[model samples]
Target: MTTSSNSSLSDVEPSKTPKNILLLAIGSMGDVLPFVNLGVGFRRHGHNVIIAANTRFRSFVEEKGFAFREVNWDMQHEWENTDAGSPFMFDFLKQGFQKSYSNSESVLNNVDFVVLGTGAAYMYPECLFRNVPAAYVCFYPWASSKSYTGAAYGRSFDSLQWLPFQLNVKIWKTIDQVATFWSDVGLLPIYNQRLKELGLPPAERLPWLPGGAFEKNQIPVIHALNRNLIQIQKNPLNPLEIQMDYPSLNIKEELKDFVPPHDLVEFLSRGRRPIYFGYGSMHSFSDAESRVLIWLEVMSLLPQNQRALFSDVGNIKMKELDDAIKSGRVFIIDHIPHSWLFPQTCCVVHHGGSGTTHSVVRAGVPSVVVPHFADQPWWASILHRLGVAPNTGIQANAITTDKLFSALLEVLSSEEIQEKAAKIGSKIKKEQKRSPVSKIVAYIEKYWEKTKWDVLTLDDEQQKVKVKDNWRQVNGNCYGNRMMNGNDDMQDVYL
Candidate 1:
């Protein structure tokens, strides 16, 4: 169940016992950045906060001055391009989950709240076991709703464009079910195995994706998105499934004095603001070299008077494109926060990630969204609908340098789109002063306050616990004097 919009933040009194808050950042830097910001909020509220993410992101997270923990492993190592009977990393789930459990549970000693990012669905049961007040944070909308639509497995809801609306959702659910089969084939065994080891009952697989049922039976779900730019469906079934603006700030107040390297600063001063071209962690699995060349060639073809910035995430060294880099018009950067860089650019060319889309819009700039896959085309459509991006958007698979150049030109030249972008930026800036994290932590606080329950930790030292008369059993799990059941309605488990 969701907390009321009227839940007053003032009601969240300073805790007599500051809780340990753990945030899991399982995907890319975009996924991790928001949590770091959230951790900063928790820190200010007099709680100990830890940011756990990929090993590679330690410095990035630590730079924000939060304690850090290495998650499963570096995402790149897991997703390394492999065609030798390993199309995906399903075979690696056992090692990964075990590693995750080993590393995470050790620090979860006092973790009162665990904020699970979009990709950390497997960790749900562990939270249940620990009885930690957990919440799921979704960056984009994938579940099918009658009023709003999104992409599924890199295909838009409109892929089955001719089907009736109900049929469309059914089709998406079917597709997600098949994908879930393969995914569960890898994760479910590990999940149940982990539970068995903990002496917990094996859980029946609950609805995860499609039909937007992922929110069902899960922890309170927060959709961190800008409502103004997104066309969410007409119906929102769950009051707890909240949608809020993606914070304009990705770092804390202490790190706000970020200095772009002197070279980057000099490059910006030398010419007109360069258009940015980047695809975060895109093409990490296949044809990376060819994609790199295509990106550079498009940057090279920019109007002679215009300059461009390109992110070389793949670290492909250039033999042929050396001239373009030497031309002083193209700057290749390894990593820079979009929070600082996007506003300096006249426009952006990106993969239309939820984070990047929000970043560019909040930076007061228009962009050309060249979506590669999953929620990207969805964001692209939102931009087009909002008139912040031109047309629908260019699909990455079919992109040509000429097509990219033309889209770039459209974004740069369109005054209407540019102005609308600036207005949205202004709104986000105003909201930033109020701090989304304050509201978020308050929601988290409100959730725990409403459900004043306790947990009996089931660990090696304590396989079972002696309980008072207040503790009772339901669905084979004990809740602290709470009455809940799955027999009636879509079950909300030991919540």
Candidate 2:
């Protein structure tokens, strides 16, 4: 448990508190929802939190009673149009960042602190130039470490585990380079242009080096994962990482006064608890019709007494499945908050987005994760490791009716898995009662306390002097120099 010198900053109290915080969250609903919960926490504590996300989330963000800024990226459109296995996913992400940078400068001008998501790391160099304290909010582990396989790659190299640590690191670095090459090419030019406009030197054209954002900016990271689900091992690579419980905004209480559709309510009452199947925003399959057909086949294999609730949130067209909807065995819904619905279900099956994974886990329901891309497979693996899902779950490409039926039957019949899930759900409920937001707020305040003195006490000339000194220190080391030259390709090594 060795600590850094900045550990003292954890105790400092700021002379001036940061009132305005801009959280730039640019991804799927899964990515944005957690931040929305965090923003609610910030607002409760008297900070004016503005969530800058895709325009599609405007109503969702505004409904939460916080200021909303619209970024140019639409996750729904990208998800529906892009293939899950496309290498262009990283390029698309980079474009989103570029668009965000162009539109968010005005919003950034007013913010006292900036919190960015994992995909928005391109903003860190600019945050450094502006001297605004910034922290990264990651839903998954982004830093390079030896404790686990890199989350970005979504697979482990078990055969390479016997290799030396340095060799493993190099292998991981090479994998990242191949994965993120297009993203780097698309993003670096735009970022360099922004730096030039700000009267700063252009940043290095670095590939997406794991943990480079926090390392380069010397800021803490608020990781939004429960330690109970995923234990945080000390990453010798990045010491400033803070693991907090998942921030869940359960909307069930708010919906208590409201009424569900009459048919849906009746369906819930008529049968034993139904199984839920929804992919949320993932459109990995070729088309909605094909997915529905496969789902129908899978549902036919279920016991006569078991009903199913199918969500048509992404590309799935519920109208096309009129026979299933009319039969009363299956109910097709546009969208329902998982927090409100998952507990009522016997089990859940879906594309394993982080939000969906956490939601079903908290609901204490067994899961059948049909992973598409990105961290979905990794999360499915976690659920399996936790005994809440079948082994390895089901990969998207390999999903057949038989495989789906087998996996679903195994979980549904396993009393051990059910009991384990219930225990995990109990733990999650206990954690939810203990507000993760308050702890995060306190940590942010401490960050301000540590840096505010220097930022406030220095005169114009002294500030320039301090900036120069800090820049020299930041760029002096071999690692720093490599980062500056875009040569540092830090990688996570797994045993």
Best by TM-score: 2
Residue-wise lDDT of candidate 2 within 1-495, one digit each (tens)? 012354534556632443788887877888788788789777777788998888889998998788888877775577666665664565666565566667656657667788887666666655655556777877776433544445565553221557875676566555555554544566667766765665555444431243343554457777777776686554445556667667675444435555677877788998799988888777544466767777888888888778888777355555547777777778877767677788999999988877788889989889999888777776887788789887666777788889888998998999999999999998888767656666776677777666553344556566545554554444344253343345645433211
Instruction: Summarize candidate 1's per-residue lDDT along 333-436 as a digit string, tens digits.
Output: 87787878888988888888888888888888997887766677778877877888885678876887788777876877789989998898888777677777
Q: Tell me the whole-model lDDT of each prediction, alpha carbons only.
A: 0.66, 0.68
Q: Please give the lDDT score at residue 264 for candidate 2.
A: 77
18 Cα displacement, candidate 1 (Å): 1.0
> Model 1: residues >4 Å from true position, as ranges?
1-16, 82-95, 102-104, 160-187, 207-218, 231-238, 247-255, 283-289, 313-320, 391-398, 455-495
Q: Which pairs of residues clash in candidate 1, taking residues 3 or more apart in a chain or in different chains?
A: 147-233, 147-234, 148-233
TM-score of each: 0.80, 0.84
lDDT of candidate 2 at residue 400, scale 0 to 100? 88
Candidate 2 TM-score, true structure as reference:
0.84
In Å, residue 69's CA in model 2 sits off its true spot by: 1.1
RMSD in order of candidates: 5.8, 4.5
